[model samples]
Target: MPISHIEHYNLRAERSMLETLRDFYVTVVGLQVGYRPLSSYGYWLYAGERALLHLSEARPGDPREPHLRSTFDHVAFACTDLPACEAHLRNHGIDYRYAEVPATGQRQLFFSDPAGNGIELNFAATPDS
Candidate 1:
């Protein structure tokens, strides 16, 4: 059997940081806090009906390796409204860099979360008049 697309991605942090992560993903990333069946300290963020991001609380004594966090370059999310996203990031006082794909002209905004996890937002190129 073939595997399908990514069902979801999870980020684990301490309880307090987990809450902050939830807030950031919800408020800044435009995800909604939805029903999470697991009765744990975490959140399930949904783009529509599907929960694409999961925030979990890291338990004490859980081994956290530096390489584990830094290995993956970043997690990217397809986005729209480049201007609005830029404004939102600026309003939140988050520093971000802008770039475009030379071949596709697709726009991208890169920034880090409170926990220093890289986040990328990709936008379709705007049409010329």
Candidate 2:
């Protein structure tokens, strides 16, 4: 059998960072909190029917790594209506950078969340535009 797509990605975070991550993803990234079902503290963020992002609380004894440079870069989403996205970000006072992909004409919006997690919004050009 062939794998279909990425099911989800888990982010291990300290307790304090959990709420920050939650707010950013919910308010800015446009995800909804869903059933996680884990005994530990954290969240499962859903985009539509599938939970795309998972958060797990790091215990006191868990090793904490300095994120001077994060090895895992950013999560990207394909979105519609670049104008609306820009206005939403502006309304929220979010700082973002925009660029068009080399040849695809896909517009990219890059920004960092409260906990410094990078996110990308890709807006593809529609046909007959």
Q: In candidate 1, residue 98 scores what lDDT?
A: 93
Output candidate 1 Cα RMSD: 2.1
Window of ten residues with lowest summed lDDT in model 1:
63-72
Off by over 4 Å in 1: 63-69
| Residue 55 displacement in candidate 2 (angstroms) | 1.0
lDDT score at residue 37, model 2, on the 0-100 scale: 85
Q: How do the residues 28-100 of candidate 1 rate in per-residue lDDT, one tens digit apiece?
A: 8889999999988889999999999998887889843322455767789999889899999999898999999
Off by over 4 Å in 2: 63-67
Backbone clash pairs in model 2 (N, Cα, C under 3 Å; residues 3+ apart or in different chains), count: 0
Model 2, poorest ten-residue lDDT window? 63-72
| RMSD to native, candidate 2 | 1.9
Candidate 2 lDDT at 121 equals: 97
lDDT of prediction 1: 0.85
lDDT of 1 at 36: 96
